[model samples]
Target: MAKSKDISVVIPLYNEEESITELCKWISRVMESHGFHYEIVIVDDGSTDNSWEIINNISSENGSVKAVKFKRNYGKSAALNTAFRCSEGDVVITMDADLQDSPDEIPELFKMIKEDGYELVSGWKKKRYDPLSKTIPSKFFNYITRKITGIKLHDFNCGLKAYTSELVKSIEVYGEMHRYIPAIAKWNGFNRIGERVVQHSARKYGQTKFGLERYIYGFLDLLSITFVSKFKKRPMHFFGTMGTLSFIFGFIVATYLIGEKVYINLFLNERARGVVEQPLFFLALTALIIGVQLFLAGFLAEMISINSNKKGDYLIEKKIGL
Candidate 1:
């Protein structure tokens, strides 16, 4: 077991070689000024630049700076997941390496977690430095997120956030689910989430690594988390409901068509077309087949859910006890 620290600043960086040294220095000043016993854990997400080298040098220069390098670009979620597993801080803080997320908020965030009794605290970039291109889409995304998760944080994707070590350890962040950390925490029974109006600065170095596709992925991740959180232990609840409805609808349509044909032939005493000759017959047959397939899918999903372990198993290339 590692010695517990007051705070562990976990940064997930990609090609952020230029700003890291300055970021670390700023963080060190904040931590030292606050009289905090902190460790800076930087996860280098397979940067092709000198980011890894810079990380090694920074760790050597500052003994409190620990490092982890991924073998490839596994993404921000993977980086956070790996660092959370190894953090030794009572309250863990996650921030971006782009210099947009200020280290000055660390003390207040720490206080919210320790003194204010919040399980997780998310930073809200109320006055964002980002342009309308990013901000507009972000607002739309945040609105949808707030409506769905019922956590009214203005910015769900803000990197500047704090969590109790227990909260981070209990939840898993994979894919683009990092944006929904609070939702994930809530799903794991940590509902005491707080939001702080943090200062968001303009990027000092490196262009935004993400593109418009991020919102698309974010929405997909939201749907995934919603389904998984509700039905992970019982996938049959979702798949089975859809399957049953489809099967019942198809059966009703088939029966109605068959009964109409029988009535025309027997009661009306008129010749009726054969069931197979009508297009309705094929449509009903297709629906029945689809319904059966959906039911089988639900059955298979249930079987898999019984044995599934959904936690991430990312490959760590290097670690300082991380």
Candidate 2:
């Protein structure tokens, strides 16, 4: 007899053939107890090892198991993106390929999304088994994300996330932004994001591919998201604001110079130097030039905001399809 599938688990795999089979067995044991139809989608992200072969064998044994292979390593984002397209379950769960993220927590994540009305539910590793090297940078990253994104979750990048199809399709998880899915989902107007403390086992296979540099990238991405959120439509609002402030500060400096000359002429009873001779004149001139450049920048940004529909286009006119 064949089992009907209701829940789809999408795992992005890269050089983890040793762990895939064990992970699948665990998933089968835990998920079948819930008495719901489920399918496992393993996205092979260009693994140089025999991961694709392993996934193919599993898919043949169990109709519920599916595999998607990439030609080369396009990263976790591309893997997830491809897996999302292949999913067919009512609930879609995303977890790491390594055996660290526990399959036992899948039921709870499923319950949260299906019953609790949460559009997205991410797992929180309150007590991670990772070393201090990984954990320290992770803490800083999560801290900044909480402050800027305001989701207040302990772990935003915990690969064990459950999502409905709506939230999945609304947000794009490219360029290391997969680590900030909660932030992206929030920016897209999905605020019903909930988090649960899930079990985090030590990695039994494969080394952590990420490094501390991801924290730096994450902080920069936070700034990018914040800017895009506040000024996506009115980019001039940001640039124009800096331009106006610079111009005003420059004007104030020039005004001070005028006042100094006025005092010398009136009180000291001496002829004052012309505005052109004062050193303040050069300062004001520099300020004015900088201000003009910023203003022009804002103007150009406004025009770009109007036409930045294609993000990959380097030359603005190239996107015009000419």
Each prediction's Cα RMSD? 1.7, 5.7
Candidate 1 — which residues are off by over 4 angstroms? 1-3
TM-score of 1: 0.95
Who wins the TM-score comparison? 1
lDDT of 1 by residue, 1-322 (tens): 7656999999999999999999999999999998999999989888999998888888878999998888899999999998898788999999999999999999999999999999999999999988899999999999999999999899999999999999998988888889999999999999999999999999888799999999999999999999899988887777778777777877888898899889999999998888788887778778777778878888898899888776677666887644
Clash number for candidate 1: 0
Model 2 agreement with the true structure over 1-322: per-residue lDDT tens digits: 6554568898988999899999998899888888878889887777899887788778777777877777778788777876776677778999998998999999999899889999899899999898899898898888988988889898988999999877786666666667778888888899999999999999898788788787888788778877877787887787888888888888988988889899999999999898879887888878877887888888998898887666211111100000
Report the Cα lDDT for residue 291, model 2: 83
Model 2 earns a TM-score of: 0.85
* Per-model TM-score versus the true fold: 0.95, 0.85
* Local distance difference test, each candidate: 0.91, 0.82
